[model samples]
Target: MVDTGSANRRDDRTPVLAVAGIGKSYAEGKQRRTVLADIGFEVARGECVALVGQSGSGKSTLLNLLAGIDKPDTGDVEIMGRSIAAMGEPELTLLRREHIGFIYQFFNLIPTLTVAENLALPLELNRIPSAVRRQRIGDWLAKVGLDGREGAFPDELSGGEQQRVAIARAIIHEPALVLADEPTGNLDGRTGNVVLQLLAHLFRDQGRTLILVTHSRAVSEVADRILALDNGRLTHDTEALSW
Candidate 1:
């Protein structure tokens, strides 16, 4: 049976992510606005966790903190066992480049880049050789069901197609952690379902840790654990971890 309550470590592996005493706030003119306060959790390696909450529930804020895109006002975030708070900007950038992948709510594909070019981007940024990049692009295109549309521009493709490209691009380099923010929010029901399945299958097959911020029940259904945030704190966590 699967261990949803704690890290499913094979031996002595560490958790993929650990958020401790996390608190984040913003200034709305004069007073401070607390977006997330004293929130904490750990995501195990190879586990898929769904973060769900009503709109304006600090979900995105928490995700940004996890990705090191935003700093916590009080507390620390650790990814792959490294402290996000301790890293300088250059170090953080390298950490993100080497270990993280992201899928945005709106498919953030560069309009000028073709499907193949977009998928080839992460590999290119990591300085993968041209020949190996080409091979991976071809493979990922087929994996995401866009095999023959490699040269097509973003505008030429449908919403679902663009998202497929996004998914393919995000995982092409096999980052240890993948952060998806409302990945299927813009697609129709059927199309969204297809994309979600692709995400789960590919992540599971590759043994990557996935933390998805979503409101869809269908998305949460696939996760090993479901966490809910309210106002600026974690109000509910199903399957609490023992460690």
Candidate 2:
């Protein structure tokens, strides 16, 4: 028999994210290569989980799958008990817009938009009322320590500041799950720690589920659980991990 990865515990409350028997493959010439196989795990509501591994471990691919940016070749990804495979691109886009917040390594901010406008873009796309959007933008900007820099364009901000803006834009809508792919990869140790702490603390205070991908041991230590992504699969999961 083959091992089916691992799990922590099944809390009575519904999981914010669940992946069962997930597998992915791609064609290499005339043959197929498996990227991930038999991946399974559950992240409880309000839990912060880290997916850690070396490069080429398929960690980012898994993030894309979970965020509904790509489809799995097998098994299912359920966010809030809804199967992501059952939705189309439009629906998946809306789902992400409404419930998922994504942060990237390079801080993908719109260069043409000021910090304030960029932060307000998602709210406007979601059709949040103008008054409410304004308030949320102001609130999150301050929360992320970007209040005074709101009028600065992305190109005008420093690396750390740009990342803060990215984070502010992500959580402005109070997403249920925040998927961060190497959110601090571009920062130096000091700045990286600050960004990591801000992300972790925000999730903790809001009771939101967070799936963060990082290779930094210090970063993973902050999570409620540490999940290993190996050979494109979730091979191990440990709760309340301490170095």
Candidate 3:
């Protein structure tokens, strides 16, 4: 059985995210299909939480809810102490740009933008000065082992290299939260393992809160807590984890 003992440790600080009683549904052929039901969880600052389940188990639905890409029919979602459920699209956009970062399974890098430009996009959107953005791009690219490839476009890089660019883009702005959806799903096992270890280490060292949705056991092993989703509900909130 999944343990709830750590749920009591939430008083550690204000959670980076607080999800309460969230539910989502869609209509199909005049029938309402529920995708998630009464889902609730809290991710504290600097914590890495993993959501694992079979395909069609609503893992992506939960990630969408957390990212504000979709809204729940019931319940509220608070991010960085702000209520996302009540925000209009414009406000939500601003909040996301300013405080949240996303890493996608497909690397989501703009094919037309060069590597350095891609990494600088977030900071540019935040209106940071060009000099600062340039410096950050240079430093992060080197850290990701892609130094001197700044002028290359996404199409010019291999899958692993593209993913490394995605990672650099996600954290360059130093957002308070990072949401990764099957981050390594596109790489071979060995390459995926290397990227996963890099991501886990970087997020921890930066003290960024992470909520990762993944099916890989290797990915799940890096989380500080593991929660399992079944059907439309959370079936497990495993015991506290360290490392």
Top lDDT prediction, candidate number:
3
Which tens-of-lDDT digit does each residue in 39-89 have in candidate 1?
Answer: 989898899999999999999999988989889989999887889997888
lDDT of 3 by residue, 3-28 (tens): 56665455447799999999999999
Q: Compared to the true structure, candidate 3 yields what TM-score?
A: 0.93
Error of 3 at 140 (Å): 0.6
Ranking by lDDT: 3, 1, 2
Error of 3 at 202 (Å): 0.3
In order, candidate lDDTs are 0.89, 0.87, 0.91
Higher-TM-score candidate among 1 and 3?
3
Candidate 1, residue 170: how far the Cα is off, in Å: 0.4
Cα RMSD for candidates in order = 5.2, 6.5, 6.1
Give the range of the ten consecutive residues with the poorest summed lDDT in model 1.
Answer: 4-13
TM-scores of all candidate predictions against the true structure? 0.92, 0.92, 0.93
Q: Give the distance in Å from residue 152's predicted Cα in candidate 1 to where it truly belongs.
A: 1.1
Order of the predicted models by TM-score, top scorer first: 3, 2, 1
